[model samples]
Target: MTRTSQVVVIGGGQSGLAAGYHLRRLGLDFVILDAQTTAGGAWQHTWDSLHLFSPAAYSSLPGRLMPPQAGQEYPDAQHVVEYLADYEKRYELPIERPVRVLGVHRDGGLLRVETDSGPWRARAVISATGTWWRPFLPAVPGRGDFGGRQLHTVDYRSPKCFTGRRVIVVGGGNSGAQIAADLAHDPEVTWVTQRPPRYLDDEVDGRALFDAATARRRALDAGRTDTGGVASLGDIVAVPSVREARDRGLLKASPMFTRLVPGGVEWADGTRAVADAVIWCTGFRPALSHLAPLQLRGRRGRIATAGTRAADEPRLHLLGYGDWTGPASATLIGAGRPARDAAREIADVLA
Candidate 1:
């Protein structure tokens, strides 16, 4: 069976929820197709120890402010999950769950969202599926030969699993730092990075990163010289746990290994170390496979966009992917503006 709506949202995460809020406010009919069985989106899948980089007040959706978690400054993954569940309830967003979207194909006057459940036709389709489902592991030589366990950020649940084992944590981003720190006390962990990890000052957090991103966006809009945003601020934010781990000398990073051997990994200088497991916190690519039918992606593997609207496919809007769709759009606090913009544009086109 085929359903029809004025707009169809491809995700029910922070970004998708934000779009739903704006679309509802605009009095537009829409449905949010979520692949997950329940709420919380990607937060439900994150490692148990994961915490937001900013305080609750600094991290919130468009309509509701996330209430402070008692006895905690930065909220954990569960807190985020609860908040999202509550947000969806509060707004009464029309979200369909466990509906895996197959692809989006252009119809004569609308877009057909093909999903496992059925097809939905919409005048405008907002693709808000974020990247957590698509973990990106860099290609390393002899990776297949490694007899030990290998997992990506998406597969990691807790450091307890690696307890008492020799583990190698790869990547230099926030996940890498956090996972390595989480494992350091209990396990023999070697944090490997392509380059030395650059950490933001203890005082800096997600709030500052959002501010910098906003400033950069403004400067670019005014045709002024670029203000290096988050990149200028450094890669890792010294969260409390990470800071404590660093001070205790547990977060020390080593140069990236040259290749994976059956016993372990070897560096360019032929230094070898044995590890029982290798955890890759290498990050993710945008989960855009469902959008493949549109053929809007460019040579860079990204869909060109004018604001949130796809450059080639005007009926399609991309949301919550990252800076390309909007400044800081991937974060809870940053998804609002882009979502609002996309909703208003869709409303205008439909009207």
Candidate 2:
């Protein structure tokens, strides 16, 4: 086994797999490091009932086609995992699974990556480890005090779990909206958010959001970072899920309560809402502790993502950044642009 691979890609999820496949097609010697025992990244963490809003046709990696599912919506997380397994088998990419990367440090002109299983050296490193690293929940004053099994959207699995519970889902992003809609159908769910997302409707096609993402990427490539953000003015008019919640009266268009008191949460408007559970739909921040030495500049833990996909960190390349990656870079339909470009950039450095 060659200890020194020319390139090392960290992660085995969709983006990492895509990057690895692109490197293979480019004829670059590389290895993919994944922390999970499986290939799918967040898919493994997503709730069981989840299915991608995007259809299967556009979800394939650049070279591989998602096996056709004529009338089905995009495959669920398990299906994605199965597809990934097939992809790894079909491509024969060198992937070391369950290899938790502890630290990535430069040693003697080589990048040394220490993992739980072992160590590897490479000339280039691509952190394709998608953006779902950390689950963000705003610190409520008495969150622990009134706790009735609180969890982030990251830990949420199915509406069935909240079937008989008075659930309060927080946050206004895509995940929160979808989860709220799903839970609303259970007759025991009600949602409140601090700020309503200016969410775009999930049209039959997600092209608008995707295209906006592309434009945002262009701006980033041109050295812009503050251009794209909540597109709405405290209103979620575009999202199908959000709309459904509204239609069902399950969603309350109000800011989150000021604090989570001993028995319930206090809304901003001085209304007290009590519930058996509070689901923090709060967004996430990038957990890049492994890249501590990179000195990435950005508010919170989010690096100032810029360029083609903005997943291009100065010291690393991230593939599955959030919706900001643009139309062609955000979804399975468009993530290749960044992977290929990042591959070339890595190639240039390691050449």
lDDT of 1 by residue, 1-351 (tens): 999999999999999999999999999999999999999999999988999999999999998999999989999999999999999999999999999999999999999999999999999999999999888888999999999999998888887787688999999999999999888796478999989999999999999999999999889989999999899999999998899999998789999999999999999999999999999999889999999999888976899999999999999999988898999999998999999999999999889
Instruction: Give one digit per residue, the lDDT tens place, for model 2 in 1-351.
Output: 327788888888888888888899888999998988877777788876666656676677878887855456556778878787888889998999888888777766777778887788877777766657777778777887886778888889887787678877887766777788778777666666655545554454444445555776567667877456335222343345556676667665456677787667786677887788888878776556666655564665666655422343344566666654334454676777778888877766656
What are the TM-scores, per candidate, against the unseen true structure?
0.99, 0.86
Q: State candidate 2's TM-score.
A: 0.86
Candidate 2, residue 196: lDDT:
56
| Candidate 2 lDDT (Cα, 0 to 1) | 0.70
* Residue 84 of model 2, lDDT score: 79
Q: Which regions of candidate 1 fall more than 4 Å away from where they truly are?
A: none
**Which whole-number lDDT from 0 to 100 does residue 99 have in model 2?**
86
For each candidate, the alpha-carbon lDDT, in order, equals 0.93, 0.70
